[model samples]
Target: MVKIGVLALQGAVREHVRSVEASGAEAVVVKRKEQLDEIDGLILPGGESTTMRRLIDKYDFFDALKNFGTQGKPIFGTCAGLILLASDIVGQESAHLQLMDMKVERNAFGRQVDSFEAALEVKGIAEDFEAVFIRAPYVVEVGEDVEVLAVVNNNIVAAKQGQYLCSAFHPELTDDHRMTAYFVEMVEAAKKELAS
Candidate 1:
C-alpha cells in the first residue's frame, strides 16, 4: 500500500489523513523531517502560511521538504499549502518551497467570513467537484508547463505541474475523495517511473 504523508506542522492534518485513507492509501501524519523518507507522497494542508513556515524552519524541515519534491515524489498542496509551493507570492519577498512555477495571491477570496463552497469543474477529474474555500488564494499566473485544473469566478483555483498538484480550496473539507484519489494516482505513477 502507498503511504501518503500529511505534514502535521499545521492545518487540516487529520482531515487529510482521513481523506487519503478514503482514497485507498495508508496515511501518515508527518511531524518529523525523517518521516518524509517513509512516504510515497506528501500533502501540505491548509493553515496560516507564515506560521507554518516558522514551524517548518524551527523543525529544520525547510530543506527536506524541498528535496522531497525535487526527488520526483508527488506533492499536493491546498489553500495555505498552495501559497507555500508557489514560486512567487503577491506582496511577499520570498515564497516557501518555490516548487511550483506559479504566482499566488494569498487570501484572494476575501476574509474568513467570505468563505464559501462552489462546484468546480476540475479538468481531468470531475465535472463538478465540491470545493470548500476558506480564506483561499488564487493563482495569478502559471508557467507554460503548468496545467490549469479548475477555476471559479474567473479565478484560477486549482492547477497541476508535473508531480506537483495544488488547490486553493480544501477538498478534504468535503466528503469528495476524487481529488485525493487523483493525487494518489499521481503518486503511484511517479513511483513506477522512479523504479523503472
Candidate 2:
C-alpha cells in the first residue's frame, strides 16, 4: 500500500492519518525528518504556521522537507501547510519550503470566531466539496502553471501545481475523504513514475 506521512510537528495530525487510511492508503505519523524516507508522500497538516516552522527548523526537517518535494514526491498542504508551501507569503520576509509557485496571505479569512464551512465546487475533484475553514489563508496569486482547484468568495482556496497540492480548508476535519484520496492517487502515480 502507498504510505502517506502526516507531519506530526503540529495540528490535525491524527485526523489526517485517519483520513489517509480512509482513503485506502497507509498513513504514517512522521515525527522525525528521517521518516520522510519511508513514505511515498507527505501531508503538512493545518497548524499555527510560525510554531510549526519553529518545530520544523528545530528538528532540522526544513531541508529534508524541501529536498523531498524537489525530488518529485507529492506533497499536500492544508491550511497553514498551504502557507508553508507557498513561494511567497504576504507581509512575511520569506517563505518555508517554497515548493509551490504561489502567494498566500495568512488568515485571509478572519479570526477563529469567524470560522465557517462552505460547499465548494472543487474543479476536477468534486462538484460539491464540504470545506471546513478555521482562520484560513487563501491564495492571493498563483503562477501561470498553478491550476486553481477551488475558489470561495473570489479567493483561491485550493490549487495544484505540478506534484504539489494545497487547500485552505481542512479536509481531514470532515468525513470527506475525496481530497485525501485524490492526493493518494497523486502519490501512487508519482511512485509509479519514479519506479519506471
Candidate 3:
C-alpha cells in the first residue's frame, strides 16, 4: 500500500488523514523531518497560512520541505496549504515557501461566513463535485507548467504543478475521495518511474 503523510504541524490534519485512508492509501501524520522520508507523498492541509508558516519555521521544516520537493516526491496543499505552496502572494508574507509560480489573494472571498459550497468541474473526476471553501484564497495567475483543474468566480482555485497538486478548497472537509485518489495514483506513478 502507498503510504501518504500529512504534515501535522497545523490545520485540517484529521480530515486529510481520513480522506487519504478513504482513498485506499496508508495515512501517517508527519510531524518531524525524519518522518517525511518515510512517505510516498506529503500533504499540507488547510489552516491559517501565516500560523502554519510560523510553525514550519519554529520546527525548521521550511528548508526540509523544499529539499523534499527536489527529490520528486509529490506534495499536495489545500487552502492555507495552497498559500504555502504558492510562489507569490499579495497579502502577508512573513513566511512562504514560494513553490508554485502564482500570486494568490488570501481570503479573497470575504470572511469565514462567506464560505460556500459549489459544484466544481474537476479533471480526472467524473461528475461535478461539491467543493467546500472556508475563508479560501484565490489563485490570481498560474505558471506555464501549472494546469488549472477547476475555477470559481473566474478565479483559479485548483491547479497541478508537475507531481504537486494544490487546491484552494478543502477536499478533505467533504466525503469525496476522488482528489485524494488522484494523488495516490500520482504517488504510484512516480514510484514506478523512480524505480525504473
Candidate 4:
C-alpha cells in the first residue's frame, strides 16, 4: 500500500489525512524529519504560510522537505501549501519550499470575509470539483514545465509541475475525492517507477 504523509506543521492535518485515506492510500501525519523517509508521497495542507514556514524551520524540516521533492515523489499542496511550493511569490520577500516553477501572489483573492466556493473544471478529471477558497493565492505565472490545471475568473488557481501538484483552494474540506484521487494516482505511478 502507498503511504502518503501530511505535513502536520500548522494546517488542516486531519482533513488531509481523511481525504487521502478516502482516496485509497495510507495517510501519515509527518511532524519530524525522520518520518519523511517512510512516505511514498506528501500532502501540504491548507493553513497560514507564515506559521507553517516558521514551524518547518523551528522543527528543522526545511532542507529535508526540499530534498524529498528532488527524490521524485509526488507532493500535493493546497492553499497556503501552494504558496510554499511556488518558486516565486509576488509582493513577498521570501518563499517557503520553492519547489514548483511558478509565481504566486499570496491572498490574491481577498481577506477572510471574501472567502468563497466555486465549481472548477480541472484537467484530467471529467467532472467539475467544488473548490473552497480561503484567502487563497493565485498563480500569476508558470514556468515552461508547469501545466495549468484549473482557472477561475481568469486567475490560475491550480497547476502541476513534474511531481508537484498545487491548488489555491482547499479540496479536502469538501467530500469530493477526485482531486485527492488524482494525486494518489500520481503517487502510485511514482512508486511503480521506483520499483521497476
lDDT of 3: 0.89
- 57-100: candidate 1 lDDT, tens digit per residue: 99999999999999999999999999999999999998889999
Give lDDT tens digits, candidate 2, residues 1-196. Answer: 9999999998999999999999999999999989999999999999999999999999999999999999999999999999999999999999998999999999999999999999999998899899999999999999999999999999999999999999999999999999999999999999999899
Worst 10 residues of 4 by lDDT: 123-132
The lDDT, on a scale of 0 to 1, for candidate 4 is 0.93
- TM-score, each model? 0.99, 0.99, 0.96, 0.98
Candidate 3 stretches with Cα past 4 Å from truth are 92-95
What RMSD does each model have against the real structure?
Answer: 0.5, 0.5, 1.2, 0.8
Residue range with the least summed lDDT across 10 consecutive positions in model 1: 186-195
Native-to-model Cα distance after best TM-score fit, residue 42 in candidate 4, in Å:
0.2
Q: How many pairs of residues in model 4 come into backbone collision? A: 0
Q: What would the TM-score be for candidate 1 when compared with the true structure?
A: 0.99
- Total backbone clashes of model 1? 0
Show how many residue pairs clash in every candidate, following the order shown: 0, 0, 0, 0
Model 2, stretches more than 4 Å misplaced? Answer: none
The CA lDDT at 113 in model 4 is 98
